[model samples]
Target: MIPWVHIDTGTIPNGGGTLRLMRRGQEFSIQLGQNELMNSRLSGSEVALAELACGRIAARSGARVLIGGLGMGFTLRAALQTLPERALVEVAELVPSVAAWARGPLAEVFGGILDDPRVRLLQTDVAAPIGAARAVYDAILLDVDNGPDGLTHPGNDRLYDHGGLGLARRALRPGGVLAVWSAHPDAAFTRRLRDAGFTVEEVPVRANGRRGGARHRIWLAARPDGAR
Candidate 1:
């Protein structure tokens, strides 16, 4: 087995803990404390989530999209491929080192994406972008933390709550979609989407693509044209 090399490191939330970026062969992973948070190899969910989020909106000639996480750049790359030439994607990633790894060690997989004119990388918490956007996006795709029950960062739990869902609803354009990727099911979180005045639909897509294997749920919520 090849040895894993440390690419870089950063702390999550005021240095609450450290996140180590490690590489083995062509794959990369983000580890928090001792657990592997996310990796590039098993990125099926990222692609599915991005596809589900973009959906028909991506077919629109000039749609604007917001992607909450940039892990592996699978979601961004998928979106870039599906969307039209004039589409725009704003990627909000909290960890700067993750971005660094994307450009450096993991460059072969994610580097070219950074140079795409359609993409804008924002090094900030996903919440900030959601809060600040004023009904400006056609779709918002979130895969920041593990799931509704956040394991890496407790702060991310709010994203699955009514408050965060409400903000997401407000940030989206009329009939715009808000797609969330989860590692597993969260019934209560689905209810929260309804409570926030979104027409919700739960879809299961494989981690590897539509071809086969264990499935994961993707919550697609849409804000009503007259909600606000």
Candidate 2:
């Protein structure tokens, strides 16, 4: 049996604890304590997060997307694959070390997507970009924390709350979609989305691509054209 080798560790932003990177041959992982945050082997839910949201906005030309996390770059890469060439992506990663990991140990997984002309990587809280936007983006996908529970960063809880949902609504164009990735489902968060004037859909997806793995959740919320 091959033992997992610890490669490195990075501190999570906002006093969110530390993430340890581990490798065992072809597989890689980022973990917080004993719990795994993300893995190179299981990217189905992350990819679904991008594919589902982008598919909703496929008709829009030059669509703009904002991804709230850079976890192993799976969501970003999946988005890049799904979106049209004219589309653009802005990835907001709160932890500086996570970005460094992406460019460093995880570079092969990221595959130079950071250098893509269509991308602008921002090392800041997701809220910074969301607050600055006003009907400017076609889609906003948040794969932060452990979803509505806010496991990594305590501050991430606000992203699923009413105020955060409100800002997301304002940031998106008419009929724009807001996608959220979670390790599990939250009924309260789903209710909050509707309260924020978004028509929500909670989807169940596999962790690994079309195969065996734990089920994850994705919330697809769309702002109607006439939504205020």
Q: Write the per-residue lDDT of candidate 1 for residues 1-228, one digit (tens) a residue.
A: 999998888776644477898889877888887777677777787888777778759766679999987878899998888888999999998877778878777888785988999999998888898999888899999987667765656777778788888889989988899998887888998888999999999988777675665577788998887779
Model 2 agreement with the true structure over 1-228: per-residue lDDT tens digits: 899999998888668898899999988998888889899999999999999999999778999999998989999988988988899999999888889998898899999999988899998999899998989999999987767867778888778788989999999999999999998888989999999999999999999969869989999999999777
Global lDDT scores for all candidate models: 0.83, 0.91
- TM-scores for the candidates: 0.92, 0.97
Best by TM-score: 2
Can you give the lDDT of residue 39 in candidate 1? 77
